[model samples]
Target: METQMGTVEDNEGNTYQTVTIGAQTWLAENLRATKFQDGSAVNTGFIPKDDDANLLTFGRLYDWHDVIDERNICPKGWRVATDNDWKLLERAIGISELEVNKEGWRGKNDIAITLKAAQPDTIFKKFNQADVNKFHFFATPAGVKLGNWYITQDMYTEFWTGSSATEKDAYARTLAYSWWNSHKGQIRRAKLQKSNMFSVRCVKI
Candidate 1:
């Protein structure tokens, strides 16, 4: 397989490495920009960098509102991955396009094992297992934040899709270390409340 790597700069001046998978260019890291495209502060659901190590690894957690802001959360030339964008990624990895766009928890449970990043031995040393990472997407287990509490720090990983399912809920994708294979256990397409926070990954426009 052939791969090309590059870099993109955010409005905040943070540079992220970009990897081309199939025809799509994806950020090799989670978005850590603290401002929108216009340079306005992103105040809500932005986790402060109390721990530089975690911030560097996971990037920032953002709510759906922050993601869809007209000012734009991603860096210039890139935008948050929409449902279709994610479907394209899945298809690139050999998942049927038929299973790609399905709304709720679709696709075989093994897709997560394919796209999920290999957990660092420095962080998850006990779990010696590594992900297949067929496309070099480098999706880490950044976990999610709920209100004042941070839960599932190292166990579960989720990313927000630009598509909103309803006024109250938005679409997202997830991978979990637990139950690596059960009928709908590992990878799931979830419709979560807009306020629920998850990590963001951007796709080139």
Candidate 2:
């Protein structure tokens, strides 16, 4: 039988799920693509050309509009995932919610730790236990932007959720590393932080 590509680990471990989708073995990690997958020239000025590559460990942040542009971003066998694709993952991990958590959060709540990357030092603190990730998600708090204004570093990992708002400011989902519960996910926009450059993680769809 074919097993799923990803593995489950606690937030304290450094493992991430690398799945094979459509003949491609890919990381479940956030895309940190500095260049469009085809090696084409992409604009890095959105982020400082000199930002420490290591700290932006996932990949260069792309706006929702950019991800929408088919010109390029994902590799040959892959495409940037859609909202439906993410929903599938959430379902797989039993994180689905037709309603909301006590916090009135929008998306599912069960998969937070499963999606968190192992960073014990950075894991959100809840009750008394720091997340051991327990889901191989290794989610990190890469600071984001408001059009060149870098904002919150130690608290948020606002990522492009492949969904959009009605306006120019793109829609995104943020996971707070300092908080105790994953139920409090925040969704925000691009124009709100056009200055902050963060990380990327693409899904194979």
Best candidate, lDDT: 1
The residue-level lDDT of candidate 2 at 90 comes to 48
What lDDT does candidate 2 reach at residue 48?
Answer: 26
Candidate 1 C-alpha lDDT tens digits along 125-200: 2332444565566677677877876777667778998899999989898876543324212356778999888888
Per-model TM-score on C-alpha atoms: 0.85, 0.65
RMSD for each of the candidates = 3.8, 7.0
Q: Cα lDDT of model 2 overall?
A: 0.49
What is candidate 2's CA lDDT for residue 127? 28
Model 1 lDDT, full chain set: 0.75
TM-score of 2: 0.65
